[model samples]
Target chain A: EAGVTQFPSHSVIEKGQTVTLRCDPISGHDNLYWYRRVMGKEIKFLLHFVKESKQDESGMPNNRFLAERTGGTYSTLKVQPAELEDSGVYFCASSQDPREKTSYNEQFFGPGTRLTVL
Target chain B: AQSVSQHNHHVILSEAASLELGCNYSYGGTVNLFWYVQYPGQHLQLLLKYFSGDPLVKGIKGFEAEFIKSKFSFNLRKPSVQWSDTAEYFCAVSWDYGGATNKLIFGTGTLLAVQP
Candidate 1:
């Protein structure tokens, strides 16, 4: 089975520009998540999707960032009017159904899209 | 706020040397710990995970981690490491928030360099 895959392995855009990063989760996986690493810092969670509905999005930093999983199989994170601080690597991950909070479920990650905002 | 810390920013070891990387997390209540490795030009991959049961867990590529609840630590270890083991190691912890997602808090990551 193929693991999670991300589009536009690397992206460069000017400040105030818009960029959309896509993530395709593994087949049959119902849980999708987005995370990012800024500079050399640790990876931080952004949001999560279970099927077509968003399970949690509290991690979202601000209103300028938006994430959607239309059909529940793929997800897109769009950043409007990107800032200089938006330069970093965005990673997408997926796992089996996450109905049970405490249940152990392995999450596979993608190669990550490196976004550079100048 | 909860957090994860990886003490070693970088470590250098000769091939066949014993290895141990310290990972500490601060979070009350139940948590699931994980160790992930990212090789050069590669995506992050799961090295091992600890949800419950035996605190000691073994993973692929001869890597292992022991979860010590008292210490609030889950340190990665290997009896012997090879040159192929050089990579960036990250430690993460996810809390059981009784919510839809387990928000994973990750460490700054440690770079391991193994000499041939």
Candidate 2:
């Protein structure tokens, strides 16, 4: 089984430009999540998808950020008019739904896309 | 309101030395704790996790973590460090959101440099 994979391991874009990061979770995994780590800051949760439905997006930083998971497969996070503060690493993770008897869900993470806004 | 903290921002140790990294979380409800390591040019990988049962959980690569509920801490430990152990370690806590999704809250990682 392949782990989570991300596209464009590194991205450099000018401020105000739009950038979209893609993530493909492991096969058969139903839960997908997005997280971001700004320089000198902790990694923060962005959003999560159980299948194609958005479960919780409270961690999203602002309105300019958007995430989508179509057909319950892969996910995409788009940042419009990116700001300097948006420069950091964006990580994607996925895990199988926990069984009724199991309380643990181990998440597998991707290599992460490093976005640099100048 | 929930947060994770890793007090050691960076650590330098010689090979074969004992290693310990402090991690603390502030959350009253039930939570799952994890220690993740990212080696050079690699993605985040699970070092160890604590869900329940024994507070001491052993993971791959001889890594272990002790979860202390009273201190709200899950600290990573290794009896002997190797040069290959140099990496950035992140401590994270998972909490249910709306009782549906379990999102991870991570701390600012600690960079461990093991000198050979």
Candidate 3:
């Protein structure tokens, strides 16, 4: 089975521009997640999707950032009026199930999309 | 808030050198730990994970980590490293996020540069 895949390996945009990053998870996976790592910072969770519903979005920075998973197939993270601080590598990950008795399911990650907000 | 910390930012070593990277986490209650490696232009891969039972856990490529409950740490170690081991190592902590789910928090990462 193919691993998770991301689109537009790299993206460049102005501070006020809008950018959308996409992720396609492995077949039959039921859970999807988004994370971002800024320069000199650790990777932080942004949000999670269980099928088409939002499971947890407390990590979302602010109103400018939005994420959605349509039909529980693919996910898109859109940053409207992107800011300089938004420049970082956006990663997407997926797991077969999130209900493991021990919560020890292995998460497979994508190569990530590098966004440069000028 | 829960978080993970990696003591080393960057480490350089020659092939066949012993390796040990420190990882500390601050979180109440039981926590699951993991070490992830990212090679150049590659995605993150799990080196090892510790959920329960035996504190000493072994992973692929001869990597192992020992979970010290008292210190709240899970450090990765390898007796001998190769040039191919050069990568960015990230320490992560996973805890219950309610509803039978877990969320992972990653560290800043330690870059290992192995010289052949």
- For candidate 3, give the lDDT of residue B56: 100
TM-score of the B chain in each candidate versus the native B chain: 0.97, 0.96, 0.95
List where candidate 3 sits over 4 angstroms from the true fold: none
Model 1 interface DockQ? 0.77
Alpha carbon lDDT of residue B115, candidate 3? 100
In order of DockQ, best first, we have 1, 2, 3
In model 3, residue pairs whose N, Cα or C atoms come closer than 3 Å (at least 3 residues apart or on different chains), thus clashing, are none
lDDT of 2 by residue, A19-58 (tens): 9999999999999999999999999999999999998899
Of 1 and 3, which scores higher on DockQ? 1
Best by DockQ: 1
Query: Over the stretch B1-116, how does candidate 2's per-residue lDDT look in tens digits?
Result: 89999999999999999999999999667888999999999989998888879999999999999999899999999999999999999999986433767889999999999999
lDDT against the true structure, per candidate, is 0.92, 0.93, 0.92
* Error in Å for residue A75 of model 3: 0.4
Chain B TM-score against the true chain B, candidate 1 = 0.97
Candidate 1: regions farther than 4 A off: A101-103
